[model samples]
Target: MSRPVDRESPDRLYTITSGRSRGGDEVFDAVTLVVAECDPTPGMQSEHSRILRMCQRPMAVVEVSARLGLPVNVVRILLTDLLDAGRITARHPTAVNSAVSPFASPDVLEKVLVALQKL
Candidate 1:
């Protein structure tokens, strides 16, 4: 059986995103990787702190949403806050030339395939 989803109420989401419907100038996609730049400070929002701890290692935006039980759009807005505060850094996926090999090794390609399948 699947675990029950644990999403917060819309009101709580709104409060967390500060009434924003979308992220600021920074653009984020499902596969974009995020990493914490530093530990969250005292008095920081609980969500922000959680994100910091969760992102100590690189994590995709979609994975973050799944783990946090938050809507992707809401997560993007929250990420904007962290980006503005310099608490996190986002790395967008780069395009690979059709003529070039995308992965450096077969093992690397296999690992990426496994990760995508997990999602």
Candidate 2:
């Protein structure tokens, strides 16, 4: 008898990630953004190639996980491989004026204050 096919089988995931559970030294979260640094090469792993194609433009890690129908952790492992190969780059999202503070900009705070006063 033949074994049933399952896309998310543990064996499949394990094989894809080379039996590793954790990614490289770099930390990758769901909202982290990734971009392809170069085109996919022949004989590259299918998942890696697909990731490269998807990341032609900056794409969030969560979006990639959803699109590929894979768990976030699995995607992170794959991204780490590409990152190590220098085929992709990853970055966490940041606010426009993050250097100043976590609070909203002065203009936005003023608007909110005026609206509250009206109420």
Candidate 3:
């Protein structure tokens, strides 16, 4: 059977995030892998608890954002608090940001830029 949806009040997100636009100084890339550091308490915010549960087996930041239907930055902030509090470990999937295009290498990138300029 499919899992039931967990609906929240329209204002829930604002409350959860405290109206902040940034998560923290810790930069978690979209593909960063995160795992919960401990079992979340029932008293915690629903979003935090859900994130901890979903992260038990390791999940990417992008996956979490999509699952929770929250923007990437918002999720990052929540995760940053968790991480700073030692509640989770955010590991970058690779040394390079996956969002970067394959042609992003300086040599090829410059060549492409020059060609585009000529066009």
Candidate 4:
């Protein structure tokens, strides 16, 4: 017999389906598995919420740190907590091109390069 899903249980499974556009081809994929509980203390709820928001889109520690305006070390600590709680996950920069490009256009690139040169 199949095990019944426990509504009260924090541990639940989720299926993440995605499609990729590769050379005009549409490739579909699905990942299904049980995720661990994500219960954060009231004091840390906001932080956890922010991390969860970030996780919806793949992000690096530096990107999260910059977006949240938190120090890299602090972000790292928070990420560790989220990882332990199964609220967030990390991926290598190369494994996925999730990094938001600071420069998306030639004009923006030029400005950034100029600013870096001045610094």
TM-score of each: 0.75, 0.77, 0.67, 0.42
Model 4 stretches with alpha carbons more than 4 Å out: 1-44, 95-119
Model 1 worst lDDT window (10 residues): 97-106
lDDT of model 1 at residue 3?
A: 65
Which runs of model 3 end up more than 4 angstroms from their true locations?
A: 1-10, 95-119
| lDDT by residue (tens digit), candidate 3, 14-105 | 67788776765467988889999899997888888999999998899999999998878878889988988899988876576545867667
lDDT for each of the candidates?
A: 0.87, 0.89, 0.83, 0.48
**Tens digit of per-residue lDDT, candidate 4, span 46-73:** 6556766655656556666677665444
Alpha-carbon shift of residue 17 in model 3 (angstroms): 0.3
Judged by lDDT against the true structure, how good is candidate 2?
0.89
| Candidate 1: pairs in clash | none
lDDT of 3 at 1: 94
**What lDDT does candidate 4 reach at residue 6?**
50
Candidate 1, residue 72: how far the Cα is off, in Å:
0.2
Best by TM-score: 2
Question: Over all chains combined, what TM-score does candidate 2 have?
Answer: 0.77
Ranking by TM-score: 2, 1, 3, 4
Per-residue accuracy of model 1 over 13-105 as CA lDDT, tens digit each: 878888888774357889989999999899999888999999999999999999888999998888988988899999987877645765766
Clashes of 2: 0
Output the better candidate (1/4) by lDDT: 1
Which residue runs does candidate 2 get wrong by more than 4 Å? 1-5, 24-26, 96-119
